[model samples]
Target: MKAYRMLTEDEVLQLKSQSCLADDWNNVLVSSDFNTAYVHHTRFSGNVKLGSFDGEFTLKGGIKKHAGLRHVTLHNVTVGDCCCIENIQNYIANYEIGDHTFIENVDIILVDGLSKFGNGVEVAVLNETGGREVLINDKLSAHQAYILALYRHRPELINRIKEITDFYSNKHASDKGAIGSHVMIVNTGSIKNVRIGDYCYIEGTCRLKNGSINSNADAPVHIGYGVICEDFIISSGSHVDDGTMLSRCFVGQACQLGHNYSASDSLFFSNCQGENGEACAIFAGPFTVTHHKSTLLIAGMFSFMNAGSGSNQSNHMYKLGPIHQGTLERGAKTTSDSYILWPARVGAFSLVMGRHVNHADTSNLPFSYLIEQGNTTYLVPGVNLRSVGTIRDAQKWPKRDKRKDPNKLDYINYNLLSPYTIQKMFKGREILKELKRVSGETSEIYSFQSAKIKNSSLNKGIGFYEIAIQKFLGNSIIKRLEGVDFKSCEEIRARLKPDTEIGLGEWVDVSGLIAPKSEVDKLLDGIENGDINRLDEMNTSFETMHQNYYTYEWTWAYNKIQEFYKLNSDEITVQDIINIVNQWKEAVIGLDKMVYADAKKEFSLSSMTGFGADGSREEKEQDFEQVRGVFESNPFVTAVLKHIDDKTVLGNELINRIGHLA
Candidate 1:
C-alpha cells in the first residue's frame, strides 16, 4: 500500500513548465520521492498517481534512459516506483503498473468494466458442438482436464468442479488489471482486460485480450511478435509467439506454441509443442507435438504423440455437426499422410501408417502397428515392444522434461513398462486367445474389433504379449527382492507379499499420471461427496498418488502373478523365485536381441543407395560407416547389447544366491 500526497503548488508549477497537464491538478497524486525533473510532455486525468523517478533502464545496446513519464497519457493509472511509461498511442487506464517496470511504445492498455481474465471460460473440447466442456483456470492440471472432459456421466462431480472453478474465477474478477514488477512491455498493440504477472516480457504482440500471463522470476512467459491471444491463460515458462493465434485455450507450464501455430477450444499441458500446425477442440497432453504446416489435429485426445507431415483426422466425416471425437493413447505415432476416421481409439505406443475408415478400437492391444492394406486395417500386436524407437522414446521422456519451475502443476510418470501397459498386455493376451478360440487355428485371417489379424500375425502377437508379460512381472519381483537374501521358502513367500491392497484392481493413465483406477475413483468419489472440495486438495491427492506409484504397482503385479503363473503366494519358495529369474533373463535377452537386429537393419546394404553416389559397393560401405557408423559400434546397438549383458549378470547373481534351495 503506497501512500500518495497531493502535489505542492511549486511542484505543480514545475510540472506545468515541463508541459504536463491534468484535468484538475488537484486530482493528481504523487509519492514523497516523486521528482518533477523527468516528468515531461505527459497528460494526466481522473485521479492519476505517480511514483518516484529514481532509477535508470539499460537497453540492449547499453544505452541508458532515466525512468519517468514522457509523451504519455495516464487516465486513472498508478505508476509504481522507478517505472517508465512513454509514447502511448492511446491512454493507459485502470492499470497498476508495478515497480521497476518499463512500458513504452503503441496502443491502449485498459480494463473495460469487470473481467475475470480468462478463468472459468468453457472450452468446448472433444465434442465441439456442446457436451464435453472444460472450464480452464490458471492452475488446471492435465489430470483435472482429463476428468472434466471424459467423466461426463457423473453429473454431480462435473457440477461441483465447475462451481469450484466459478468461485475461484469470481474471486479473481477485478475492475483494474495489473502489470507486475520487472516486466518489459515494448512496441505492443492493445492489451485489454489482461493481467500480466511478474517478470513477463511482451514485445510486438498485436493483441492480448481477456488473458492471464502467470509469469514469475523462476519461469517467465514470453510473448513475441504478431501474437494474438484471447480468453486464454499462458502458464509459467510458456512461449507463445511468431504470429501464433489462440482463442479459448489454456496452455500449461513449460509449453511452446509458435511458428504460426493456431489453436482454439483446446488445452495444451506440460512439455507440449506446436509449430506450423492447427489444433481445434483437442486435448493435448504432455509431449504431444506436431511440427508440420499441413498437420491439423482436430477433435482428438493425444499424449506422447508425434504427427508426421500431412497427418490428419476427420471427426465427423461431414455428418452430425462435428460431434465425433477420437483418442490416440500415449506414445502413439502417425506416419506421413496418415488419416483416421473418428470414434476410433488407438492403443498406447502404436503406429498408424495409412488412411483407415474402419473406426478400429485397439485400446487393449498396445505396442502394435496398424496398417492399411487394400482398404482393410491390419493389426500387428505387440510389435513395438521390440522396436528400438519405442525404447528410445521411453528413455528420453524423463531427460526431455522442460519444466524449470520448482512447483510443477503436473506429476508425470515416464515408465514404459508400468502396470498401466502391462495390465493392457494381460487383457490383450486374453482377447487374442478368444479370437483364436472362436476362429479355427487354420483360418487365414481372423477379425477383432474392425481390424483383420492374419494367422501368423495373431500367433506372433500372442508370443509377443507373453514375453512382455514375463518381462514386466519378472522386473517387479526382482525389484522387490533386490537386496534380500532368502534362506527358506517361508521367507521368500513373506517377501513376495504386497505392501498394500489398494492396487489389486485395474489401472489407468490419466493423461500422464498412471495410477490404479481404484485410487482415481476414490478421489472422484471424494470430490462428489464434498470431502475434497478445493483444487489444491485434488492436486495434493494426485501428487501423493504419483509418489506412491511403485508401491501400488507391486500390489497389482502380485495379483497378476498368481493369475498368470498359477502359483499360490503362501506356497511360493526360493526355487520358484529362481525359475522366475531364469525366465526373466530369457525374456530380457530375447527382446534385446530383437532390438539389436532392428538396429542392424539400418546399416544394411540397401540403406546406402543414396549415399556414396557413383561409387563402388565398397566405397558405399565406407561412406555409410562414416556417416551412420559401423553397425556393432553404433550407440543404440551397444547400449542394447550392454543391457543384455547387465541383465544376464543380474539374473545369475540372484540365481547363485538361491540355487542351493532349488
Candidate 2:
C-alpha cells in the first residue's frame, strides 16, 4: 500500500516535456520514487497523479504485456507505473488507475461527472406503476427490498429507508473513479462512471455506465463479450456474459446471467440464474431461476422458484397498465406454458399448471396444485407433499447453493417444511372444512378462492394436510428427545415443550429465510424505529430468526397437537404418545410409498418411447434399462426404501420406551 506524494519541480518539468499538461503542474502528484521512464506516449490533462507500477502482467492467453503508459489521453487521472494502457479511442478521465492493471483495446474509461456507481437508483420492482420502488445499492438484501416494496402502507418507514439509501449514495458520490489492482479490461466499448474492483476480468463488453463491479481477489467478477449493463451493481463471484443486457438491476453474489438474458427494473439476489429469458420489474430472491427462452417473469416477487419453459405471467388487464404484482412464495414452481394473472398469491412448494384465468389465491394451501381443466381452475391441495420432484428439490437446494464467497450477503434457509408452510397447512385444513360445511357434503364441486375443489379432493386435502402436520410435529418431538434419556413422563413433557413463544402464530418466508410472523414483525418494528438502519443489521436479524426457527416451530406445533389429537400435552398419557407415533409411522411410510410409485412412472412404457426409438420389444426394454436404469436401483428409490425402514424401527423404539407406562 504505497501512499501518493506530490510531484517535484524537476519531475514536473520532465512530465511537461513529455507532453503531459495539467491545470497546474503542482496539482499533478506522484509517489516519492515515481519513474519518468514508465510514462511514455501518453498525454495527460487536468490534475493528475502517478504511482510506481514496477510489476509485470501475463495475459490470459500467455501474451506478455509490460506496465507503462502508451497512446492514451488522461484528464484528472492517476496512472501507476508498470501498467499497460493503450488504444483508448476516447480520453480516460477522472480515474485513479491502480498498479499492474492491464488495459488494452478499450473505447473509453471515464468518470464524466460526479457519480455513485448506480447506488440509490430507483428500481420499480414488483409493480411497474412505481409505487414500490427499491433503492438499489451494492449491499441491498432481499429482505430490505421486500420491506421497502411491500410495506408501503407504512409511509414513514418507507421514507426512512429512502432517506437512508439517499445518505449512502451521497456519502459515496465521488468525482474520481477507481480501478483496482490486477484488473483486466480488454476489447470493451464505453465504460463510464463505473468503479472496477480488484482481480476483475472484463472482455469484449459493450456499454457499462453508472455501475459498480464489486469484484475481489476472493470472488472476482467476469464480464464477457457483448454484454451491456447500465444502472447496475454486480456483486462478487458473478458472471455476466453472452450478450446479456441489464438495467436498473443488482446482480448479487455468485449469480449467472448469460445467453442473451435481458433484465430491467429487477433485483436478482444471491445465487440466482437467468439464461435466455427476460425479466422485468421482478424481485428475484435467492435461487430464483429461469433458464428458458420462452420464460418471461414480470412484475412478480419470488424466491427459490423454478420457472419452467414457456412460463409467463400477465400483470396488466386491458384497463390499467402493468400495475398488478403477484407473489409466489418460496419453493413454488410453474409448469411449461403455465400462465398466472397478477395480483394472485400462490403458496410455497405449490405447482401451477395450465393457463389459470380465475385469479386464484391459494397462499394458505402449500404443497398443492392449481390446474386449469376445461377453463375451470381445479385445486388439488397438499398432493405435492408426496411428489418425488418436491422431495428432490428439498434434498438438492443446500447442495446446489452457488455462493462460495465467505461473506454471504443473504442468509438462506432451504427447509421444505418450516413453520411458514406448516401454519399454512393448519389454515388449509380449516379452509377445507369450512368449504365442506358450507357446501352440501355430497356436492360434486365446491368453490373456494376462485378455484373449484371437488368433494373428494376437498376431503382428501384435509386428510393430507393433517398427515403432514402429524409428521412435522412428530419430527419436532423426536428431535427434542434426541440424546435425552427421559426417566419420567414430566421430564418428557418438559423436553418436548417449546423454548420460546415466538412460534405460536403464523410464519412467513422473508425471501429464502423462514421465520415466525412475530419475529418478522419485531424486525419490522425495529426498522420503523430506526433500530435496524444498516443492511448488515437487517440481515443479522434474519439470520437470528433462521437460527431460532426450530424453537419457534415447536411452540406452534405443540399447541396444534392438542387440537389435532384431542389430547392436551399436559394430560397426554403414554398410550396417547404411542397412538401419535403409530399414526406418524403410517403417514411417513404411506408418503414414501406414494413417492416410490410416482418415481416408477418414469420407467413405464410411455417413458421408454423416445429412448428405444430403433429397437424391437426386447431391444427396447434393454435400451430403456441401459439408459434410464432400473427403477428399483435408482438412488431416490433406495432412499425411499431406507426412509421406510428407518421410520419403522424408530417408531417401534419410541413405543417400547413408553410401553411401561402404557
Q: Pick by lDDT: which candidate is best? A: 1
TM-score of each: 0.97, 0.95
Per-residue lDDT for 602-650 in model 2, tens only? 8889888877678688888999999878889999899999999999998
lDDT of 1 at 26: 90
In angstroms, how far off is 537's CA in candidate 2?
Answer: 2.2
Best by TM-score: 1
Over 4 Å off, model 1: none
In order, how many clashes per candidate? 0, 4
Candidate 2 deviant stretches above 4 angstroms: 4-26, 79-82, 656-662
